[model samples]
Target: MTDEAELLQRLWNREKNSIDEAIQIYTPYLSTVLYYMAGNSLPKEDIEEIVADVFIVLWKNAGRIDSVRFTIFL
Candidate 1:
């Protein structure tokens, strides 16, 4: 399986550092998406907050997640 798949598994297991890895990988993508979704009008802090909340949600729901499903969900 792909590295991202492994990461998703780790997230499901609540392995330490998995969320950090996920944040590193997805934060930029999330930020850019949020920017465009908000018409690029949101302040940087607001974008950051939204991105953080996304990760937190992922962590909370990781047990039911898989990379394929998550990529589609994202």
Candidate 2:
């Protein structure tokens, strides 16, 4: 299976490490996107807060997430 697939599966199973893996994999991408979307107005700390909120939402909804629809979470 693809790495993302495996990660999603682990997330669905509530594996603690899966969240770490996800943050490692996605944080840079999300941070960049958020930074750009924020138009450089928000502080780094605000961007970090938004990113954390995103991960929290992802974790809360992991069980209902479709493995094939992983991109939806992002």
Candidate 3:
């Protein structure tokens, strides 16, 4: 598997550093997703906040989420 996929699997397994890895890896993608979801109607700051909220949700639900393929699942 790809290195990212391996790291995601580790995160899913509850490795402490995995959360940091996920945030670093997915922030840009999440921002893009939020931007499109908002229809670009929100200000940059608001969009960034929304993206942060999405990561919070992911962290809160880490155990229940299948992090191995979370980017696709999200």
lDDT of each: 0.87, 0.91, 0.76
Off by over 4 Å in 3: 67-74
Candidate 2, residue 67: lDDT? 87
* Two-way lDDT contest, 1 vs 2, winner: 2
TM-score per model over all chains: 0.83, 0.89, 0.69
**lDDT, residue 53, model 1:** 94
Poorly placed runs, candidate 1 (over 4 Å): 67-74
- Model 3 clash pairs? none
Residue 73, model 3: lDDT of: 47
What tens-digit string does per-residue lDDT give for candidate 2 at 1-74?
Answer: 77788899999999999999999999999999999999779999999999999999999998997887775554
Using TM-score as the measure, which candidate wins? Answer: 2
Model 2: which residue pairs collide? none
**Model 1, residue 1: C-alpha shift (Å):** 0.8
Steric overlap count per candidate: 0, 0, 0
